[model samples]
Target: MPAMTVNDAPVMFDMDPETPLLWALRDAANLTGTKYGCGVGDCGACMVLIDGEALRSCLVTIAEAEGRTITTIEGLSRDRSHPVQQALVAEQAIQCGFCTPGIVMAAASLLRRNPDPSEADIREAIPNLCRCGVYPRLIAAVQRAGRVTRRRETISAAPAPGIDPADAARAVPAMGPASGGEADGGTTEPED
Candidate 1:
């Protein structure tokens, strides 16, 4: 059995040591946020934050992760208020949703290291591919997240009247079945 901390929670796995962390997280731990793109780790779709650094889970085995901390997209925040998450949401940086989690995680890790990274720096940091071709928006979101993070760090009490309270509040909606599409991406029709 391998012992590790995931999303600040302790866990032990009874699977083989060679099992990829992605499989361990999804199958054993029931954390589906860490996606599986290319099993060979060529794609960044399986990215996760290991000790505050972005890493491809598919290439990392359970035994290799022993005694280390892993953070999937789910663990980023209970209400999804992490600045990166908020910025992604604000910028509507998701489409198809297949690659969003990994991109978000990569951006998060970059922000953790460089809070005020340059545009070029963000471009270099987030090498994750999005089939949706939303890189421009993704960059904008990263910039927005940086601003939001800085505001939080510097602001003391109340934001100026001109500031959008929503940005400052970083409000997250309650988790449940939203009125859009089904869990399987099936379209939902409005009730008559």
Candidate 2:
């Protein structure tokens, strides 16, 4: 077993020491926000803050994480109020959201080191790929997050945790009721 501080809580992984940190977090610890993307570390979907740096969880083993601090997306903010998160929403940088967590982690780490990162700095820091093609907006979001962190701006876009149904529906248009006979528990046969 290897011990480490995850999300400010001390945890001892019961799995093999050689297991990748991503699996240990997702499978053993049941922290599913750390996604599994490109197991070879080319994709940053499994990015997490290891000892205050954004690193690919798929490349680091549990043994390598021993005696270190790991911060997953869940640990970043329980209510999605982290500046990076807020900025992401405010800038509309998230679409499909699969890579958002990793991008958020990388952005958070970068802002910690450089509170006033330029566009180029953001580009270099956040190599996480967004298949939704949000690169332009992502850069702006990072910059906005830095500003929020520095007290130069404020964002109210990130919804609080457990948003009510009305607010949620307003944020995203509600889908119309299920059509066809399914609404009444009846099945529609396939067309011949």
Candidate 3:
């Protein structure tokens, strides 16, 4: 079977070509954020961006994804401060948090493709199962996060200086809106 690349991390799959990307990521690559929910692909738990489009990892075979660039929740950001992540935090949308990673990854990709996505677009992009029922807050956070990041990108590509301790102390996300509606966290997205 052909090999698959995940999050810029390369690995070989010594199984059949039909092996699902989800299994390859979890079993072979050992990256588990791509959860297995209704392996038929209706759930967004195992969603991963393949070559830019959000595709269910359960349905994509290693052979089909050979040499294609893939980004998982882990690859969404180097640290926990990623925009989408910060948005969730600011909105306090996490409950069980099991679905947070998947949701963030999906939303991050959506924002990347379309910096100014509509509320409906955000909803349509993240179809992941969230038993916590944080949809209302989640929607608000995602939209806010997208605006924040897009503003930064368009405003200035240069890196900003670190926040002073005094300012950090006052860095309460609620004091003011984040890049959009998310808070400013020290860390970015989660590690894959």
How many clashes show up per model?
0, 0, 11
Q: Please, what are the lDDT tens digits per residue for candidate 2 over residues 49-146?
A: 99999999999999999999999999999889899999999999999999999999999999999999999999999999889999999989999999
By TM-score, the best candidate is: 2
Q: For model 3, what is the alpha-carbon lDDT of residue 141?
A: 83
Error of 3 at 159 (Å): 20
Better of 2 and 3 by lDDT: 2
TM-scores of the models, in the order given: 0.78, 0.84, 0.74
C-alpha lDDT of residue 18 in model 2: 96
lDDT of 3 by residue, 152-182 (tens): 4321122333575568746754344453332
After superposition, candidate 3 runs with Cα above 4 Å error: 152-192
* Lowest lDDT 10-residue stretch of candidate 3: 152-161
- Rank the models by lDDT, top first: 2, 1, 3
Q: Candidate 3: lDDT of 124?
A: 85
Off by over 4 Å in 1: 152-192
Candidate 1 C-alpha error for residue 10, in Å: 0.8
Task: Quantify all predictions' global Cα lDDT against the true fold.
Answer: 0.84, 0.92, 0.77
Model 2, total clashes:
0
